[model samples]
Target: MTEIDVATKAPESNATEQPAEPIESSPAAGPAVGEHCVTDRPTPAGQVSTGEIIKINDVEVYVSKPADYPHAPARFLLLLTGGTGLKSINNQLQADNFASEGFLVAMPDLFNGDPAPNTTTFASQEESQSLIDAFKLRIVETAKSFQIDMWLARQTEEKVLPILHKVIDGCRDEFADAIKHGDGIYAVGYCIGGRYVLLLGSDAQPTTPGPERPADEEAGETKTGPLIKVGAVAHAASVTPKDFASLRVPVSLACVENDALFPDDVRVAGEDVMSQANLEHEVRVYPGVPHGFAVVGVYEDATIRGAQATAYEQMLSWINEH
Candidate 1:
């Protein structure tokens, strides 16, 4: 059975040893995990065949290629991690599943190897709970909703879009021959990552030329362009209808029925936008599945597992058909 690839810190060696060779900064050099080099060791059995960190554009991406790599220049799937970034165990499993199935998976560390901003605060449980209570009461007293839109807007523009460009740029620059040559690139996003996926398809064209730009651009002229051909968003949050209307390619949405962030009405609004635009799409509500279902691996509920499996299959099918 396939197992999660957990990153373990090597124990400190007390004895002095010969000086290690100066590392070169090249794809052949492989990525570094602190002082030790990832290329020094082989990917363990049962884990994805090839797992290493590589610089895409300039940002680091944890790439996992299948054992049967170079079989046919497999389709490339650029997966966007949720707010938890690449450390999310469930997100890692999702990427592994795709790589195991012959899709080259590249996941960028959206947080640049740092914890998400809102993940921690106050430095103490008591202080955190007090703030939470005050925040909750403020929300209850005032009808003002959370500023998810503003947060998403800033993140997408400042961090997400640039990283995405770099990842695609890296794919074309470094892995052209290793990956399938065509525009078979796809994207899958969870939570805030899902919102980024929607923004990638959103109507506002990136000021910079990207893979998602019009087909009229000279082919092969721009290697760093947006190349995502299709996409899927799972239990996405903070995305609006205008976002759906801006999509250039077909997309599928695996919405959780119990998603408070992306509730039934929000899902319906997105569907309505897609339909009005006459875009080819699929939007389904997975009953009983809650938000973050795709990114929290420790939750072992049977229903959540089944829902995740179904959603994964649906994304694969959509990518296959489109």
Candidate 2:
């Protein structure tokens, strides 16, 4: 399992005083706990095989490969993580499912070997402060290792993007021979990972520009990589309006009607932002479901599982279309 050092932001006093609501109940009945059901079979393209971990910058990423060996070059599906890390049980299962569909899935560990606390269970404010400060210091040091300008951006992006670029580059280099045979590359993300997918689509640094732009001009758009065909899946998490305005790829936001973190109004606000941005996007809410409903085992409710299956089907359809 992949472990991530979770940074606990200080809880606001007002937030602490408020009580969290109960979990929402869903209408659709779903599979029971420990039930392993294969709703869809792999489309005749190939079988799925696990790939070895490869390092991109300081981060270690696990990959899944196609079994039948594509006659053409292989495309990739980059899996992003949420607040928690990629080793979550649900994430592993989702990765396995995608791999079975013949897409090379890359799961990067963003918080390994760091001083950040694994959980935010600190009892005292002082203790939490000390831990957070220490974690920030570690982040600064890590940024220095990559020669990145930490002052300019958040630690997560500063730490993550370089490694992501490296992985994309490595994929191209390692599979250059196969790529020459004509397979395409694509990306997908979930939660924070979903956000990264948007970043990679609109802001990835270009290592190589296809025929349209000169190599020198490409650097001017350092954050914009060659338009690699991409699709993104943003679950319960919401994107800021300004950021939504900049989205340049096909994306989908799946929301649960009763999500505690993002209720219907919040989700609608996010959807509105996307609409204003004029980006190709869609927002669908499953009635009576809660946040993390798509994740199997965590909720352990039949209704949640049913909603999850429906969401999975939606994602699969989007992926196939793109």
Candidate 3:
């Protein structure tokens, strides 16, 4: 399989009164309200049939369920959006592959509210720095705050984790019967989203630093949640050392050999953090893949494909074991 590389990054919420009139329910024949129903598209094999688009907590989220499967319903997967956003080629390929494997996939549009244009060319380091500055400014000005404890409680009690809960609940409501009979759920992410998977697993509390410590360290210590048996896969991104110190669940990190975003020394440092934490984790570097190799088929090398498949299979085994 081709090799790939990834870099780590830092990584939102809200509530409002609902007084609007309700819209009429879909006029189609299907399961009753709150029941999980099959919401497959009528497309030919190997093609994705668009599923449902729903408003969760005022955020528009798109959900896709597998077309068909004969196995018992005991497993589900949630695909989080990466740095390039939901419309990126890599995100789409991962979503389709997982859905085709009978896993429920949810791709939330994290950049939906922003007006940033998707561009590939950068004139210089100054331009890249400017873009980063703009992104940070926007996040500081627009992100929401939620009760950390309350959100964590919902993970086990409601079978839905925060951030993810809204999207999953929307899916369950739309396809209630299918989810009701389905197995537990898992989450996977790439790049920015990968960092989030670590954040969610660590259950870190959001707070400003007290005084002496660095700004990033001022964020409160990680909070533990009820063991929900979640298996998260993060590719090319590294978790903050302090955050990794608090993780209690099993997680895996896949590193790409040729990723310019994350250098070999940086990757080793990340692995060291995981080692110090003594957390059940694995970090494997693919020989010749570039960053985003797993999600993007940019390299057709056999080595890249094999590595991607191996990562997927390992994740499945971990999820199943849990």
lDDT of 2: 0.51
lDDT of 3 at 222: 25
* Backbone Cα, N, C clashes tallied per candidate: 7, 5, 27
| Tens-place lDDT digits, model 3, residues 1-322 | 4433433221101112232232222244111110000011112335443555556665566566676643544245666654455555445656766676667666776544431232222223453457779887556434311222232222221122344555665655655555555444466766545655665566543332457545544344424451223545535343333445445556766766645444555556555555444455656666765455555443346676677677666556655555
Whole-model lDDT values for every prediction = 0.59, 0.51, 0.49
TM-score of each: 0.66, 0.60, 0.58
Q: Over the stretch 163-252, how does candidate 2's per-residue lDDT look in tens digits? A: 677767776766555444334455656554655666665643434334666555644245454334546563534333333433566666
| Cα-based lDDT at residue 104, candidate 2 | 66
Write out the backbone clash pairs for model 2.
30-302, 73-183, 80-193, 190-194, 203-223
How many residue pairs clash in model 2?
5
lDDT against true structure, model 1: 0.59
lDDT of 1 by residue, 112-227 (tens): 66524332221234534577798875775343123322333345445566777667777876667644553557788876677667666654544455677568654422233235
Model 2, position 91, has a per-residue lDDT of: 58
Q: Superposing every Cα of model 2 onto the true structure, what RMSD results?
A: 14.8
* Maximum-TM-score candidate: 1
Best by lDDT: 1
Error of 1 at 88 (Å): 3.1
Candidate 3's C-alpha runs over 4 A off are: 1-49, 69-74, 121-184, 207-228, 298-302
